[model samples]
Target: MCNGQRTEPCNVFPKNQYIEVGSSTEVVCQTTCVRGRVFWTLDNSPIDESLSRTINSSHTVLTLRNFTHHSATLQCHSADTQQVLGGTTIRTYSKPSKISCMLESENQHGGVPEWVKCNWEHQIISPLKINYTLIYEMPLKPKTELCHSQETNCSNKSSSGPIYMFTNATFTVRAKTTAWETSSDPYEIDPYSMYKIIPPKVKVTVLPDRLSVKWSRSGTYRICHCEVKYSKVVSDGTPEVVLKKTLGANESIGSATIENVESCTNYKISVRCAIDKAPWSNWSQEQMVLTKLNKRHVRLRLWRKIAAPEESEMRKVHAMWKEIPSTCQDTFTYTIKTTPYKDDVPGVNYTDISCDNSTCDFDVSHHAHRISLKAFQKGILLAEDSVYVPATGKSLPQVTGIQASPLGDVILVSWKAPVQPVSGYMIDWTHNGHQYYWKESKYTNTTLSGLLDKKRYNITVTPLFEDKTGRGTQAIHICSRVGDPGNVTITVDPNDKSVFVSWDTKSQEECSGTVINYTVFYGTQTGPMLNVTVDGTRQGIHLKDLSPDTQYRVYVKATSLTGTNRSSERLFKTKRFDPRLLLALSVCGSIIIILVLSLGLFCAIKWKKFSEKPVPNPGLSSVALWTSPSHQKGKGSFQPFDNPSESLFDQIYTEATQKTSTSPLATSYNSNPAGGQTEEYTEAATVVAPEEQNEKPVGQRLCSPGESTALLSSEKGKHSPYRSQSSVESPTSMSNKLCKRVPVKQLEKSTPVTVYVTLDMFEQGQSR
Candidate 1:
């Protein structure tokens, strides 16, 4: 020990502790020291010679490696001071312990088709007790367990009796121990429950064309694999392997191909499923499948009969069938019947028949086939025919030739009979079907004549027999030939108030006798008879006179033994005066006279104006008339008279000057005013002026007074005949009256008056 240090008491324990032979125990040593060495000794002796104890941080540890049931002492002390801190002594005993575990059994037992075993064991000290509990479950029942405690009469006197029984399916065993009411460590037993696991239930389904199989398992089990087997049955009652297949777990349904199998064939199939970690299940129940038969089995059959008598005709038949076997039965049968038929029969020959189990037959020739037969089924009758004869006597007679000839009051007809020889031949002739007659023709050709003109006839040749008149064959209806009317010669005679018309007739062999009477039809236009005459054997006749300029159409018909023949029409035109021609000539003559009068009048007026103008002086007047020399002179002379009074006087004087100067008498007046008052003298002067002017030389000016008066009078007559005439007449009167009052010298010296006259005369005369 040292100062400022603390010491603690050490723990003392027996050196040896009693323990069961088959059990385990624990020993402990504890001590506290202060800065000192501590050690444990056995029986007051140091356990180890060298440093059995070592200084530690305020504590000490002791260890004993071995222990025995033999009594042994132990001491704890400080090594340096040699003082004992603790000591203990004990006696040791060993007893066999009961071994226990968490699990009641060590070995589990259960098996499918075999027995399984389970066992357990435990070890414990003599004073300790062991308890065991076993839990388990079965496939069809829930889990349950049993508990057994040593206190509950579980024996230690005898080795624990074997606790053997059928454990629950879900087995879980555990065991625990207690010594003198102290609990021991618990132990668990491995789960070792046994069970017979069923793999799964497999279901199988078979289809008409295929097979399907499925299966499932319980409790997290999966089908890992599967196998299928199928069989096909033969006609001999033996089954053969048709398909076999093994499939993995991933595959649930398996298929096998079997092609070209007979229709309606039956098959058997089975399937089994194997689960993961489990045996395979039993095969599922067998399933059967039948293949469908072919659907294209219905068809139609037909037959026909050929040779048959006229009274008994041909026949037709019909039948139908299917190819299936099940539909065909022994009870199926067929029959057919028919009606009477005459000529063309049905094209098909078979008759309808009753259908039974899969087979039928129809008779086509019994009477006539009426119904249609179907194989393996009842037949339906659609139609039938009855026995009848086709109409006979179809052959017709042939007509070879026909002819016509005229007879007395009759037409003779004949036709050639058939060369092939018919029963008989009938000949008939009709006139527009109104009159007809029949005759027998034995010859190859016949003739029919004496037919009227413009008449139609139908002739038919038919074969005839005793039984009945055979149908008309090769018949032809035709008009017979008509004899031409005789050529007629007509004569006409005109009288004072009447005319005579007659005609002659020609001989015709078709006539029955001589001409009986003559018929005369006359009108402006040829039409139906307006007048008829009956004359017996007379060739000439007379028709009274008709009005002149009239037209007449006459037709004569000659009566004969057969009929009357009409002659060609004779159209007569009468002679008479025509007023239209005279009227046309008169109109033409009047138009020509009017045209001639209009032309003559125009010429007269033109000549009158020409005669009034006095011929100018050939030299100066030619210049004045050809050029505009007078216009210049007149303009210059008028310019000096610009005053209004002078202008008026100038206009009047200029007009008077123009009139007096251009006149024929203008120059004559300059010759003698006394002579101008006489027509003869004026005429002579007018004639002499031009003769005197013509004598002057071409360039020399004529006498001015004569030239100026002639120019003025000529201009006045041309532009203003009224003014010129008034001026000329005024001068003539004044000259006649004032001859005595004026001096001859003044009258002679002053400008002489010139009379200008325009002579115009109209005359009416008929030329031709």
Candidate 2:
């Protein structure tokens, strides 16, 4: 820093060289000079005097409320020094925008746009981390690619190639930066006037050994002349003869003839066009043509006769050949003739046979034979073949020891081969109405399937002689039944108390005859047997209503046309119920019920006794009553009834009778209506000996009627709440007169004169 007194010093605030728009900042310029005067300017222009500015000591402050266009260079100067002291360009770094792109014609022919050139303008920075993505769009397809370039001399790759073209296609370029992206409008170039000429169309027709080709130009390109190149490629590396033909200018369509083309040969023909002198339109797309194929003569090749196992005395021979069909085709027959070497049998010496197909088979006689084959087409002999058959001294092997083992469901048939070597053996079997044949077998044993389970079958095996040269040629036959069916499956229905039985059937090979039906037998361990029949198509049957909780043995038998076989029986136990336990529980419950009832009965008896009111003890309850208006009291003997009918007297009498120790006391209670007198008395029945009681008192007064108060001695210690033991006071009865004391003895002495008492006498009195 220099002192303005001798040298000037100028400075500016906002030391940052860059600022963003829409931001407020304070700029200050300071200068030490002869006078304290400083000012600020933008972009080398003097600041507006009207704009807000402050004056300080040797410094000026300029307040920029906000930066609108911040790309200005801020300048600070001293008025006294008359020079600029400092300046800075405040880089705003706005986002990129306003992009533009166009196609360059550098690599193009006339009026053709080739390479993609793009132009973009940005306010922020040039050569900015700018990446351009170009979108090339065409009908039905749009492809995108990325490129990086600055604002100048930037263009994409050329579109003049076949796969890539600008015609009818538009390109859009977009620029991307760390901050923003902007895309330019789309641009396209028309290729109609461009130099790229579309390939012409070619038509072809084929004839015998020749191809006729016609070519025509497409689009608006005028051709001065056209050349057609015709050639065919061949093996052996030799150049094929190529024919070329030229046509005059203005001839858009022309025909060329290619002759001498071998049958079945393919040829390629192409035509190219030339403008007034421009490059020949890329050879008009090549056209391919083919001539018709020609058929030729036939050839026959016969294979040597190989011995077959299943053939009779004659050896089997096969002949095969190929024949090329002629253009004018006709049916042909392959003929074979067998000529025996020995010529023994007249008819078998020379046997000629013919077939309508391509292959022919001949059976040579027992001896060494000669075979001849010929192929004839349209009555013309095209080829012939001869085969010589040699006979071996050995004969066909004898099939012996043929046996069949019933292997559960399948039947295994095995045989022993004859000691002498033979070609092979054949086995044939019929099962379940189906016939099966096996020939040319290499193994000694074979297994058969689809047999009826546990059924019988018969199968036969024969050792075949290829040339009838064997001494013994008897076939081995065996008849046997299939093994028992597979294990019987037992299913028990717990709810229905039934069992279901099932088994697998024998294989077809084991039992070839029809399986009539299946019989299922089931029963409990100690019960009668039960059986069910199932049809041939069914293998299982359900037996319902069977005993529950029982053990059973079950077996399944399948019967075929041959015979019936049985499966192993299965032992099954049904569910069990414990009757003893249930009976014990019932008895216990009954016993408990009986005990409860007994206790209830006992309580009822006690309650009945307690509910009863004690009939005043006969001895204690005593009273007197008059019999009639005469105020006379009568008495009668009280007889005890063994059965009383709801009465207190009967209760007292019965009580007295039961207690013999107590005095045999009886009380008769009676009441009279007229006197309203009630009388009651207790009598002691003393069966005295004749001397004890000489007389009985008929009527006795224990208390005088005048003594209204009937006094009783409490010394007895017996009482009824109704009557006081001391005395019962009441009005004296009118029958106060004394009654005669007639002795019972005198009465009886007189009553021996027969005194009769009736049931009406006891009904005379009433008691309250």
Candidate 3:
């Protein structure tokens, strides 16, 4: 060894070298000690011997052709041992090239200033991580790093100012790895050329004759050159013809008018603008517009029917036609000419018939067999047609097995071919013997469309030959074929055990079908389904024997020859009680309550009246009547008493009896002292003894029942209390006379007697 350290067996030159992609490079493996035989292997795989050349015994060279790998390890080894001695990693790289720079704005449209964005078109392939730096230089400025990134593209977001347009700048990308670094070729550009323009906003207005297009100004441009292109929107499977126009530079609101556009037509339009001479911007959003209707004449498809001659030799020719669908316009009239078959025959030539509403009727002579009709709007002919009628004769064979069915708003009619050969068939349908529609079909089946709903129609299919027509087979039809029955309604019956179920059809036309029938499905919400069938003509049915007070679900299904339709399900609850019985009980209860209240009011009023009436007193009957001995004396025969004091008592008794009836308090004597005659006497007053009368004042000369002696006393020196002592006769003498006539008795002191005297009586006695 040259030095103190031991030397390796073999060493590879260019250790860990980087090379360009798709390029060939040669590596030499040499021995340090002596001339040693060596071989080359790449990444643990043996290299081809042809690619490796041995110069002498010590050096071996390996050539890598088209090295596409990122990195590969090359090793030098002894030919005999096959062991690795020294290795060098060969890395392939690409020089970053074709760099492109642009000025980008943050906003979609032209609003914010621009930033420099540079991208590397050439990719560097290397195992080591490579750093990319975007460098830009202006005419007067030094090259500066715009951005440093590990990606292929980088933006100069950290720039202090905006990138001005029209400024010439040079951009380059420098790529570097740990071992080597390379810069891309510089790209020179003008910022103005790299700026992008936004699409303009477009608006379209539909007009009667033309379309008007307006667009907002192009991005940040004062004057813009715009182009307007439009194409008619066709629905008949035809290619659209696009029309375009180039306009000069226009101001902020750019507008263009496309003249001579078709009326009542839809068109798709777009607008694109370019700033001066720069590239054209993207097309604006597409717009659709419908032009207004123009006032134009519409050609009417004329059809007519010529009736047979009547008995009066006047044939009534009924004609009805409709306008061919086109742009809407004003009404028009028709000119009908009924020409005779021969020149010698009589006929009528109606120059003009004012049919304002598309129908005309007139009577013509029987000889007039040929008819010609022309429709005109304001003296301008729109459409014309002529027909020749053939006389009634043997008709052609009629079509057989004809069937008509309604499909929504259309009537489909099909029939078997006639026995005789025919060119085609003419299908005609009429509504209410007035409006008519007909079409020619080469097939056996045809659909009659554009018919009204809720109206009956008579359709006929007649076969047409070279010169004649076969007898037509007629069938009745209606439009708007019946779907599911409409709106099922239910009403509970008054009997509580039944419900009246009814439903409606979409129209009366749906009800005119011959094979229609209704099946009503009804049941409780959770019970098995029950059904009842009804005739198609009937709209309502009475369901009987239903459970009362139960909720039920119901629907009506209408079955026709075409299809079956069901109405929406409905819910109804049955009544719990009989309505008629409850109504009768309610009426009776109201009447009884009124009668009871009337009786109570009447009784209360009667009691109130009786309580307010004055009551008659029974204590003030006449005292003299009881004292009289003759019971036969009438009440009117009574005379005034002899003593004035007795008159006071009579007046007081009369006043008391006037206010109320008097009743006797005590019955003293009813003895027959006159021998076999009885008289009733009641004690009116108690007679006081002479000693007791003198002992007290006159007004105080009253005594209790036990202290009273008698009402009348006939003892000597006794004065009658009913009379004064100053009277001409002695009190005892008059009392004795009265006692002898009436046999008056003395009441014992133990007898209970009640004496009622007025204040006037006491005053009179005191005065005496």
Candidate 4:
């Protein structure tokens, strides 16, 4: 109460008061018995509603909003009494975020196999208690394994005794947190594939005075070291020291050169690799290479190396010999011989051109010739050029019909050889910025797999005749997976019981390889199902014989050699139409279309007639058409009840008619009810109500009779516009009446709820 007077019964309604998160509650408080500002506070903090407050002569409304976690004490204070009038409390809660998963391999000590671990991580559990649950997916199995250690570290290693061992199949796990549980995305691991590592493959190429051996290994395992052993294949059984070389962990697919090796000496070489602390891999198969041969060598070449002209006869030839092979220091004996370029019978002619000289020349008739010369020391044969005649310079047909298929991590290439007899075909391709080619012996098809993904590859197949390589047929492709089909649509044909489905791949460049085919799984619910596979060259299909009015669920799966991708499922209904009804509708449709055309023609004939009617001017006022003569703007605008147009607004717009007679200003002013309008603002002050003398100390001036404000105290029979003057038994009379209405607004990531708390009203000293 303010100044010992009752505050208009000051009834804080007896009901449940609930406050919702991020919402406003405007408590329209009318303090007609008191004056001055009504202060508001929440949680002992002054309410700063400066932007949303509304004030009137009799009512002061202070809006309160709960947004900062929803718990606060709201109150209205009477400035006159310096006391709390009413207050309430609010409350709210928030949910949590998602969890994540990771899979990693931890190497084991001694010689034990590695272990595969699945680790889960989640953070966001402050101000609340949270727990977790984990489950692992088993490949080709009906049930999943509920992990025992849901805390942090989990594994499918042998030592851990996991539910399932890893294999060629995919392995994945899922996890979630408690108390508003949120599931994590599936996690996958490739650790189970470690056993598939292949033995190191070593190939050797013999060079003069040395042998170059290159070896390569496969699989995802990290190689710790590679050891290679090489030795000469000598006939003696005596114990001989073997040469060895080692490559560090950073080396794979590398070469090693063995020096100090004699020419024409066959050497055996092999390689092996191992991971850290694990068992060494099996040694590669023994390979052989030969070093440079002993004794002096000779070479012969025809001057102006081109083959002799068809009509020409004479040709020039030259010969050169070496004593130490690489140096022009000493002279050696030379013998020249001739043979057909296709045959090696070198006894046709022998010219002993020896005078401690190295090179000699001669001329002869050109007839597809071969010239061979030798350096002999005491009749000892040394090195010889077996196939070094001039090239035939002949052209061969190109290999054609080349095709390349890139699977997930592999590429398969094949080609058709030309009709001409081909000795072999050379397949060429580039990968990872490196060029590689291999020879196939007259094979029509070939495959290359394990291509790096997202890489562009160009392949060429060249047909070879003997030593000649011809022009190659080329094919190009990019390695990637076919993406999901886009915009798959299902349409029904009512005239025929069928469904047409369509979709597009749009960009062949988006795929790692070509999309070869499409498989569609579709059927009516709980009815017979049919699977259809279509050629990928086409993008759509029409499925006939489908039952009418049936609901079918269909999805498209685009397939490539690498993998398959399925589109989202679509549900469609087949239209059922009776032939008779359809014919009737067709006839009616034709009639309607004809009627529309006829109506258009009639309107064309009536165009002049319509023009003959007076057209309203755009400049004319539109309001004149709605208003009656009496309700016109200026001529004593009539009330809606007085108009006779039967407009819907007859009762809604109940404005009174204008007054006919003018009265004196003083008379009109005196006729006003609110203190004759002259002293409306200068009314007598409010009065005080007496309480028990024991309520407060005596002699205290709680209220002044001269300062009492007037109240419009009216009886039930008196009129009132805003309130019901004659009221029945009110629902508010019961204790169940609600004092506050709260709305809840929550962020998309969180959920909020309403909480109710009682309002604690405070009283001031009752001064008597």
Candidate 5:
């Protein structure tokens, strides 16, 4: 009996886990009942029942041959039981696999053949039981044709797979499978092809008769060979090939030479290249180049001539040429045509011309040919004009001496002229180069004055002609003295107590031998004068014993053989005095004393008249002594004399007054008393001291002979000896005495004392 309970189902080949479109794939089925039949399906449709039975026995393996997108779902199941035991379902996808064909030949073209074989492999493990069809398409058309497998045997085992078949045009091949439901990638079938080949790029350079070629390869090719071609264009419009050379592949650059080319000519050149021994590329655009010719053949020539009648006559010539053609190999020829004449006439002796090719010398000395011609095709010329030759033997004169004179404002210069006279003379001189001249003249001496001192100058003398032509020799060189000495000088000579003076000579010439003596005239008063003569050649003389402090006048003269050259007299004062001024003081003293004494005598006479009257006394003594009558008669009554004290007082008063007087005689007498003296006395009754009475001389008193009383008797005895009295007394008394003693009747007039006075004067005159 069937169990009513459900049991676990087995897996169905894990649902065919990993599948691809073009490669083989497999699926397996597992069952719960052992030993039963199994079947396979695709998308729920039966594929094979017998195959699924193998799966039930644990041997189920299902594969789809050449599977494609249409065969996505696949299944395997058992057949005995209606209940699903174990089965597998598959999901399919389309992938493009190769659609291939084989080539019959590399040159065919047009449509493919009808029997072309095509085959395809599958990606599922099960064999693909689907039918496949082959399609072919041709170039330049959209139409396609399907070849049946039965008719063309495209799937036959004996046919080659997918062979390209083209009758006359190129074709494309494709295959389509039925059960797989997919198409393959298209393939092209061609028989022949073409490729572009470019020639190598090239460069060419040209020189004076040679050419250079270089090239660079491109487009995946290395240069295998190279060549250069050159030619000349003939007159017939055709090229004349001149150069052709082949070079190795390794040599990308080369050069070639063309010799003996004409000057200023042009040439044409071309270059080509090859790769791995390929055919030479067409000549590269027919490149053209040019070459230059040499220009080194040149020459030159020169000439000169002279036509002086007195001097030698000569002519010189030279010639040169350049850029000669190389084709002319011989020596170059130069021609110099000359026609010489004098005085506008072609003379017989001066019209000759000749040439020597070896020396390039053209001489017209033979007087045969009338012209000279020379030619040079190569090399150089060697001829030049004759150099000047100077004459010899010339001389010049020497300069001897020079002198200058000092004349007020002008300096006179004199020089010894040369012995031999020249055509003329030129003085080349410069003063600071600012005032310079080359003076041409006939005289040798010149005066240049009014020039400042300390300036420099250079002077040169040369003999010249009237045409300003120099003798080519210098005479001498000289210069002026810059500074000179001025003209005044003074000299002095010391003589005894006098000064001698002299001056410099003033004449233009030296002084002669003769000289004049000098004189000195002097004085102190208004007109007192004196003269002194100097010795020969002496300028001054002295006056003997002349007073000091005196002013003097002096002058000088030069007496020569010619005349007297006397200078205007000048004045000078002597040195001031010493103690010698005392004599003047003494004379002035004597005059002043005489005037003072006359004044004093006038005053004394007036005073004597005023005091001539006797003075009276009113008072008398109280007591009187009487003598005996007989003694009184004998003393003559003793009458008292005028008061002797008063007289003595008068004498003392006169002496004191005279001592203080300003009178000159008084002063002189007081200073020298013993020089003159006199004495006088007067009668007076006086009481005297004993000392004073002793000092008095015995004979100084006067006495009366009849008086015999004591006081009166003493007085008479003093008067008896008057001749022996002392002489010391007042000046007034002495004068009175002398006056009285001499009898007025006997005084006689004496002669006045004689005195002399002298004065001196001086005069001074200004000198020019």
Candidate 6:
């Protein structure tokens, strides 16, 4: 290899040459020694052997085809010994094109040009240095070389003294190298037509119904034209309404008046000028000015901060406002008048605060406050504005998807629109704990400029409604990055043996360079470390197949164009069970328990009713009243009435017997008012057959008026001709007692029967 250095010569001809780019050339390699052979190389790389041919035993010709390189060195070597023989340098060149020139003048009073700069465009760059000369011709002078340099651009810088304006001039650029020279097409124009005017310094004065603008003359030319542009300044991302007026020429300080401007409003004003038919100059730096307001009428956007109530129920109200631009000649002071609100109604008593600046702090009761501020000059009120502040602001939906990015020298913040109705948004930012800057935007995004580099800033965006302000979302940002990101969060999902890892990555604007990748590092307490890699776009990742019920440490590392950053380590434990499954089991167990308790209660109630004896209803049987011991003398001592015809049982039996007398098999004995037979008497009465009746002795009846009477049989659904005989004797005069016996059947054949007797006639006889 040649190593790009010169070597001993082998008699190469045409040693140095300059060729146009993309053109071909040829060189000869020769040696005085007989039968010598050689090879060629370009830029230390072997050239194709087919491009070279032997002219004789001691000479060779090397051909370069389609030479496209800007510069290269060609070397020849001895074929047999491979020894370097000779080398030559070849370079490509391109003629400069599209040459242009412009005259520059910065004098507010401009007649002569300050300097002239001429430049040319080159399609291909050349490695060899090229010299450029600016040639120009004045209106009445011969052509001259204005400036010379080894760069594409050359400036006169008053090298030929001051050039007169308003006259024609010709400009041309000449480019030359060691082996080639060329000149661009001549460009001609009047110096005044090409000259650029300097923007004028502008100042504004407030007028009662207009704005007076004055600007220093841009140039000495009398035919110059100047325009003053002014617009109202608004904060809500609204386009300004610009108004322009022409300034008079020939004046050292040109002046223009904008009529019918708003009262007490901020305006942005700028000025630009042009001489004759030349292009207008760039606009001057914008200036903020306020228009005069009518006395006693002022508009102000007022805001307040209310601190938490003290133990005495008094809250501190810090009221602030933007400094008002004063146009009045008299000095003024701000008066803060506050009225406590009772259910949103202004109170009768008003409190006044003495203030001289844009802010005032005072104590107020725990009530809504109605505050008003007035500007007073020498005891006369010049302007007044009021604002109503509630104890608690209305809650509104917040913006979503907030993002902050750097764009050039400014930071841009954007967010998704909120769910609630909104009129605009308020954007506020602060560096450190100092005063904050605020702006209003009707758009979803806004730009925040003029930030200090490498410092952290807190930016907050709050939504605004027609009647209230919403809560704000805050974001920490740095205009310039000082270090790598260091915040990470981890969550464990035990059921799936996984964990979720998330991290905060600074935006490209906040970082020194773009972020390219992210890595999550995790490990169990005593296990080997594991890692998962993902791209920078992914903010979170799920690390699966982890050991449950184990402690693990995790962290995230970010790789960016600037460098790598690793977050602090965090420890977390995986749960033993799935929370969702546990919750479901608990709910199911509670339901099952409730169901079991309810069923058990129902069964207990049913079994009690099934196992207990059924008591007959007293209203149907009269057994409770008749079977009492007070009505009985002894066992079977109760007696029937002496006259069977007057007895209620005898009457019912006689009536039932007469009716069923025609049907010997009749088994029903019922007394019902609705003409329907009642089954309640079925077990209470028994019918006697005619044969049984005839068998009774004439003087010995089964139940005498003093003996007990039993009307029912011992078997259910069975009748017998034998009478229920009662042998107990009652010696008392029971003939006066009007008593009746109600028969009750036994539940089982082996159960003894009881005869109950009611003393209805005894009570009636005693009353008589």
TM-score of every model versus the real structure: 0.22, 0.25, 0.38, 0.24, 0.17, 0.42
- Highest lDDT: give the candidate number: 6
Q: Please give the clash total of every predicted structure, in order.
A: 93, 21, 8, 13, 63, 4
Off by over 4 Å in 1: 1-397, 432-456, 463-729, 732-768
Ranking by lDDT: 6, 3, 2, 4, 1, 5
What's the C-alpha lDDT at position 636 in model 2? 43
lDDT of 2 by residue, 20-67 (tens): 456677776665443645566888788765553657666667777567
**Alpha-carbon RMSD, candidate 6:** 24.9
RMSD of 2: 24.5
Per-residue lDDT of 5-121 in model 1, one digit per residue for the tens?
Answer: 345645555443543333433333444533356666766556663423333454444544445535457666666776666666643333222332212222222122222233343
lDDT of 6 by residue, 1-768 (tens): 232223433477786788877778999876543235677888889988999999776578998878888888988887766877677898777666776666677565555667887777866576657788888887668888989988778876766677776577788778887778777778777777667777888888887778888888656545667777777777655455444444446566777888767667778888887766666788888989877765534545555555678988778877776555654344778889877544534444566777887778887776666788887767887677665555644444789888886656678899998888899987878776446667779999998887776566788888877755676777785453344443334444334377777777544434454468888889987888898899878888888887778798888888775567777788888778766788999999999999999999999999999998453333343332122234346464433333333322222212111112212212222223433441111123332222123232212112223433223332223322222322223425333323333332222333233433221111112221
Local error of candidate 3 at residue 629 (angstroms): 99
What does the lDDT come to for candidate 3? 0.62
Clashing pairs in 6: 10-85, 110-220, 639-707, 738-761
Q: Candidates 2 and 4: which is better by TM-score?
A: 2
- Scored by lDDT, model 4 comes in at 0.49
Cα deviation at 361, candidate 2, in Å, is 5.4
Instruction: Name the regions of candidate 5 deviating beyond 4 angstroms.
Output: 1-197, 219-223, 237-239, 242-260, 295-768
Q: lDDT, candidate 3, residue 555?
A: 84
What are the per-residue Cα lDDT tens digits for candidate 5 across 386-441? 11111222243544454444333333444555665556554444445334444445
Candidate 4 versus the native: TM-score? Answer: 0.24
Worst 10 residues of 5 by lDDT: 648-657
In lDDT terms, how accurate is model 5? 0.40
Report the C-alpha lDDT of model 4 over 43-88, residue by residue, as the tens digit. Answer: 7777665823546745667665555444556666677776765555
Candidate that would win on TM-score: 6
